[model samples]
Target: MESNENEFNPQQPNEHRPEQSAYGQPDQHVTNPSFKSKLELTIFSIEHLREIAKWSKFLAIIGFVGIGLNVLGLGFFFLLAPNMSPFAAEGLNIFAGFAGFIGFVFIMALYFLPILWLYRFGDNLKKAIDMNNSAELESAFGFLKKHYKYVGILIICFLVLYGLIIVFSMLGGLFAAMGTL
Candidate 1:
């Protein structure tokens, strides 16, 4: 018997794959493509999801607090930068304060979206489970996906940056060694 590559086969080892359930269960739709509804979650899965929602909400709240702290720190720095010994000089104070503020803002901006998505995911998931609304469940998963994708992109960017830093550091060392010889 010949098998079609496009068809999902549960028996096959990675030969074919199908979309998983939004709640992270093995979708039965893999075998029966015509199934329109998402697989229902078991009691065990619901408990697990509840725990996850609680944790996600906690972490997101912490992240928001951290951003708030960053804002306060930035304000405090500007207020005190002129008084700090090293940056007391007008020119040095302005430049250092501005640079620090810019860096802090950039970091905060980079982290804000992922945290927001996480918060929304947790909120939506909790509501969905309580009400048994499929639309809310789908929206919750969408937020989760966005949270992961945004973080994944950031990780990739940082990895490439680190690789470039390493390459450049090596090249600089090589040139320095040859210059001394």
Candidate 2:
């Protein structure tokens, strides 16, 4: 039977290989594996981190714009209803105030969502970089998989906070009316 040259020869005496020292054994002088090449890993990690950074920057800009819109809406409300109290009357101004409040809350929540995404993306990016440095591919993917839940919780928390602020504002208005009466 003829063996192919491409096949490994386990039985061959590799005289070119150096003998190990007899203190049990010295460390083998095996050539580093191709997969351990620093250049390839560094390039891959840098590219991945660059992608994350780009997305984070984009989200940050969007969040800023959303926050600006919310502020503008608040300013508009104050300008239009400078002296009108919620308790004073029920009319178009009240409807406008309610609409403004809801719009502000929605805008605030929208701003918070992008911020949350940026944070979670940044966390995952750091984990990915660490994993790449340590050669822990599984852990890097695991961190990415868990990022969604963090974003979801952030949005939920923002909604709860917005609701609390609205409730407190209404309560303060009621109390102020009672104080004046």
Q: Candidate 1, residues 19-90: lDDT per residue as tens digits? A: 446555556653654545546689999999988999999999999999989878885776555566357665
Cα lDDT tens digits for candidate 2, 1-181: 9966434332322332223332224336764333332334467667867677567657667776778786776766644564564533554566666676777777577556546556555555665565543212323333444445656777799899999999999999999999999
Q: Which ten residues in a row have the lowest lDDT in candidate 1?
A: 8-17
How many angstroms is residue 163 displaced in model 1 relative to the true structure, after the best TM-score fit?
0.8
Alpha-carbon RMSD of each model:
9.1, 16.6
- Deviation in Å, model 1, residue 181 alpha carbon: 2.1
**Candidate 2, lDDT over the whole model:** 0.57
Which residue pairs clash in candidate 1? none
Q: Pick the candidate with the highest lDDT.
A: 1
Off by over 4 Å in 2: 1-42, 77-90, 123-181
